[model samples]
Target: MVQQTDLAIAPRTAMGRAVKHLRQQGIIPANIYGHGQPSVAVQVDALAFDRLRRAKNTRNFLTLRMPDGPNQTALVRHVQSDAISGQTLHIDFFRVDLQERLAVKIPLKVTGESYAVKNLDGVLLHLLDALEVECKAEEMVEYIDVDISSLNEMDDIIHAKDIKLPANYTLATDPEEPVIKVSPPRAAALPEEEVQVAAPEAGTPEQTPIAGE
Candidate 1:
């Protein structure tokens, strides 16, 4: 089932340089638009937006509550931020139709330790950190877990096709792409031996070359 978060916002009356004061007062400028809809300028409370962003994936459904109009469903499309502080300066909310499928990137999370790594001293290599999938906004997930416990030997690989997805969700990434692999442990480096310089033979050690003899 799709989850929805309701956020209250007000239509933006300020524009251009005049909007700087809104940010100073903890309001984040934003825009909302989608198919068959006119772009609507809006503003959301900075602190409230921060909390919501931290708690949900960008693919999640958001219901924008407007002061004087009907609420709209949206998905975060882009965020503009301060280069120095990384603070959000503006955001673009793409209105979404819940009934339509959308392509989204879900983060990959590794679960379960590999027996080969623990018992055989094999090294684990993570090749992919995320995967793209197509699903309705309500069916989108924050992350997909990939289990590594089945890797039993060095050179064993887990490909994108091996992943399992929720019903109604289809993978968008190439099926042959490797998501994880195990490799044999690296060889240890050998220590260098010290070189010994032999002294001159004892018999003629005192014989110095006679200059102009």
Candidate 2:
């Protein structure tokens, strides 16, 4: 089951350029909308939201506590950031129905050592980093593990269909797509002296001798 964390938020009246003042005071402007409900403008403490974002599992459901309204269960839909400074600019909270299934992308983590990579000096290629899955809010997961121990030879691959998901989770990605693979080790380059010695001299018969000496 997914874990839930409490986040305190309050309705905001700031809009457009005026909201920058809130950020100057260490508060972030945000919105809450979903389930055919009217969108709400809100704000949260920058430090608190930062802590929640840096938490172990970013996929956790957030219990938005409001002083004037009942608590709401929401998912972080999007976080806008300043490209150069990497500062949080805005946030979007998506309210969800706990019992209703929703599609979301979950990260994929490579687990277990591959025999081909450990013993054969092969390269491991991770083709997919995340998978889209459909599941109820309560069934959400932080990440799915893809074990590679079964890859014993170069060129061996693991496809999406091979992944085993948790109960109540259904894959939304193509099953036949390759997720990971092992590639043969690259050949070492020969020494310059070896190449020079292996080549024929300029006057050697191997080269078409001057037409009619």
Query: What's the CA RMSD for each of the models?
Result: 4.3, 5.1
Q: Write the per-residue lDDT of candidate 1 for residues 156-184, one digit (tens) a residue.
A: 99999998888998999999999999988
On lDDT, the leading prediction is 2
Q: Which regions of candidate 1 deviate over 4 angstroms?
A: 56-59, 185-213
**Candidate 2 — which residues are off by over 4 angstroms?**
187-213
Among all candidates shown, the one with the greatest TM-score? 2
Give one digit per residue, the lDDT tens place, for model 2 in 98-170: 9989999888999999999999988999899999999988788888999999999889999988998989788
TM-score of each: 0.80, 0.86
List the lowest-lDDT window of 10 residues for candidate 1. 184-193
